[model samples]
Target: MSTTTVTSTPNPSVFGQSVTYTATVTGITAGTPPWGDVTFVIAGGPTIGPVTLTQTGVDSGTASVTDSSLAVGSHLVTANFVNSSDPLDNSSGTTIQLVNQAATTTTVTFVPPAPVCGETVTLTAHVAAVPPGSGVPTGTVTFIISADGPTVTGTLDPSGNASVTVPALSVGTHQVAAFYNGDANFAASNSPLTPLAINPASSTTTLTTSPPRRSAVSR
Candidate 1:
């Protein structure tokens, strides 16, 4: 009888990264060599060739394969070893691998970086998935003004952008930022703080004094 064990270099692999799977075969019979080929298969994915197993000791051999094109999700990997001399002693083992989605980033911008008091300003947030992964960001983005000011939420559009208009803000320099509540495909992210200066509104006054001196002179 023979026992087969399988393992992956990167158990929790990321999308688009190569993962090496190694299988070790050991024979129960003392002093007997376990010479043969090992085949690897990924459920719902690709299958690797029957690579020749290299003898390491009197009763053990090993085989390996590298795969780089697996979808992002959970998958089952199996390794099978069959020796021609010991057909009845063939063995196989299974393991699970988790492939996670790539990371994402968030950026924010104000239509007018600076604005005066009581002026409307538009705040926009753009969310995108990092390279190695491609998709439009979905979900809601919350825009905040200053540290303890008003907060508003907006849903992402098809272009991965969300915007909200602030009716008015107090006079002073305020910090603006946006937070993206991630969806199923992407992770949550926060944008850097943006400095906004709101200057006080300007006003003008005029006064007119009638020609009282001319009326006194005429009397």
Candidate 2:
């Protein structure tokens, strides 16, 4: 009677990394053959694998093998070995976790410098990219402008840049806030933006709106 099993491994599973776990097998028949066709079953929801082992000598029930980590989490492991041609295999299982932690956290920010009340200013929301290193920026930036009250309706440009068109009905100072719509749960001020009183100066510019991104050409 012999046994074999593995309980843990080093992770980060880089391109060329290997893991090893102990296999404890005891009380073997003096002439009993070593376990063959050994396999491993990691008891978490992740990839599965198995390997073949070469016996050092007869009746030695202990051996070790290297494995590559597939995921991070608690896992129940099983070590399987076959000693008889009858096909009734030997196996064991245990639990462990592969912990993977991210280094960067998400922080929200706003754009357009500062708030400009009583004016149709162009604004954009900024989300600092990941890794916080490369000078290159990626991902689509969202744009949003909200009037403090229902008085003024704000809109955005093709580039998700927002330009306020203080309509005629809205009077007095309207507070405008821009948010990133990149994700459902993601929204923040691109700096507190405001629309000047929809009186004369702003109204004089004419509420210019291009027909949705790409629409019929207008003369």
* Residue-wise C-alpha lDDT for candidate 1, range 127-184, written one tens digit per residue: 9877655567789999888854589999999999999988878888889889999876
Give per-residue lDDT, candidate 1, residue 104: 75
RMSD of each: 5.7, 14.8
Ten-residue segment with the worst summed lDDT in candidate 2? Answer: 129-138
Give me the candidate number with maximum lDDT.
1
TM-score of structure candidate 1: 0.59
Q: Give residue 25's error in model 2 in angstroms.
A: 4.3
Deviation in Å, model 1, residue 99 alpha carbon: 1.9
Candidate 2 lDDT over residue span 50-116, tens digit each: 4545555565554566654333333455666665443544655454534332121122222333323
Q: Which regions of candidate 2 deviate over 4 angstroms?
A: 11-18, 21-27, 31-33, 45-50, 61-71, 84-89, 93-95, 102-219
- TM-score of each model, in listed order: 0.59, 0.37
| Model 1 steric clash pairs | none
lDDT of each: 0.84, 0.42
lDDT value for model 1: 0.84
